[model samples]
Structure formats: C-alpha cells, structure tokens
Target: MHSLPESKKNHLWRKLVWHTDTDLHPLGPFHLAEVYCCDESNGYAIWYVRRLAKDDARGVAGVENADYLLQYFSKNHRDAAIERAVMLANADPSADKVIAALDRLAGGAQKVSADR
Candidate 1:
C-alpha cells in the first residue's frame, strides 16, 4: 500500500493487512494476495493482476481524486465499509450479477443527487 498518496497509504495498507491476515491466510503460507495487498496501496493491485494474468488491458484502473474520495469515507465510515464490499464483490466472477445489482443502486443514488 505504499504507492497510494500519503493520506491513503496507511488506511489501505491496514485493510489489506487485516484482510490478508484475518481472512485469506488464517493458517497457511503467505499467499500472493497478502503480498499484493501489503504493498499495493499504489499500482500494486494492477501489478498483481498482471502477474496473475487477470489484467484486463481494456479496463481502467486507479482511483479518482484519491484524497477527496477518501475524505468522504473517513467522514462516513459505513460508506467506506460499503466501498470495500464493492471491491470484494467486484473481484468475484460469480458475483457479477450481484455487483450489477449494487451498481444499479449506486446509479440510482447518483441520479437522485444530480436531481437535487
């Protein structure tokens, strides 16, 4: 998580570390996920994707206005939790349908805000 801007670096790293240690590698060897999550607050997520041949060359990566976006999460912790859930869901191939449903909900929120 070193590559993210200074503000995001620590929090992302903590999440990655916590998720890796607590969820993925409860009792076994340190998996690639742990390694990637540990150092991937930056582009390391992309790096892992490439290494694992999961890189979608056509898809966009990276965060937008990282500081501003993270500030919103910091102020609303539950929103941050939702964001993480989206990330996890997006990672699962079987969950694409669920992810799409969540996206529709998110899109509706955008529409409501835009109408304000």
Candidate 2:
C-alpha cells in the first residue's frame, strides 16, 4: 500500500501518455488500462492504471489516484509478472478479477520464495 516516489510516478505517467487521435492508440477509453513496471528493492512492481476518460485531463496529477493498482512479484517472476500485466491490460476492466489474478500471482511468488 506504500506509494511510489514522485520521480517514479512521473516516469510512469509519461509511459501511460497516449493520444486518441493516433492510429496506434488502442480502443476504448475508460476501460483501457496502461501497465507500467519498475524494479524495486524487494521485487518488480507492476502498476495498472485504468483510464477514466478518453482525454484523461488529469494527467500526472492523477498518477497516485485510487484507481491505480500496484502489485509486486519476486525478481524470479519478472517475466510472468510482465506477461500477466499485458494480459490484464488487454482484457476487460474487472477490478475484482484483476485483484484476484494479481493475488494469485503474488501468492505463487511468495510460495516459491518460501520453498527456497
């Protein structure tokens, strides 16, 4: 539940920037999710941001909004974590499902570490 530093949040906001007018832009406005990952001391932190608007005028100011979901996984699970993030980002925006899936992944990571 700890928040990311302001510098890291700014970097993530930059990565999430997208223009609806661009052809490369993905479909859907509010349901669209942007995935960002950063290496942390304990593990890799994956952040999912579900856009609430097409324009998303809130910009960097909304980086720490409650709508953001942050999940951490051991470095050994980095690939899996990234894959899950991409899958969730492309899938429908179901908060419950996303949380459950992340919890499962985090559980697996913890179990692996415990086994070690």
Candidate number achieving the greatest lDDT relative to the actual structure: 2
Candidate 1, position 75, lDDT: 31
**Local accuracy of candidate 2 as per-residue lDDT tens digits, 1-116:** 99977757533222332224445545643333345666666676666544434344333322322334356779698776677566655454554454344444433332221111
- Reference-based lDDT, each prediction: 0.29, 0.47
Candidate 2: stretches off by over 4 Å: 1-33, 51-67, 92-116
Error of 1 at 51 (Å): 21
Q: By TM-score, who's the top model here?
A: 2
**How many backbone clashes can be found in candidate 1?**
3
lDDT of 1 by residue, 5-70 (tens): 674453332222112243755775432121122222232221111111123122223211111111
Error of 2 at 35 (Å): 1.7
- lDDT, model 2, position 85: 62
Worst 10 residues of 1 by lDDT: 63-72
Judge candidate 1 against the unseen true structure and give its global Cα lDDT, from 0 to 1.
0.29
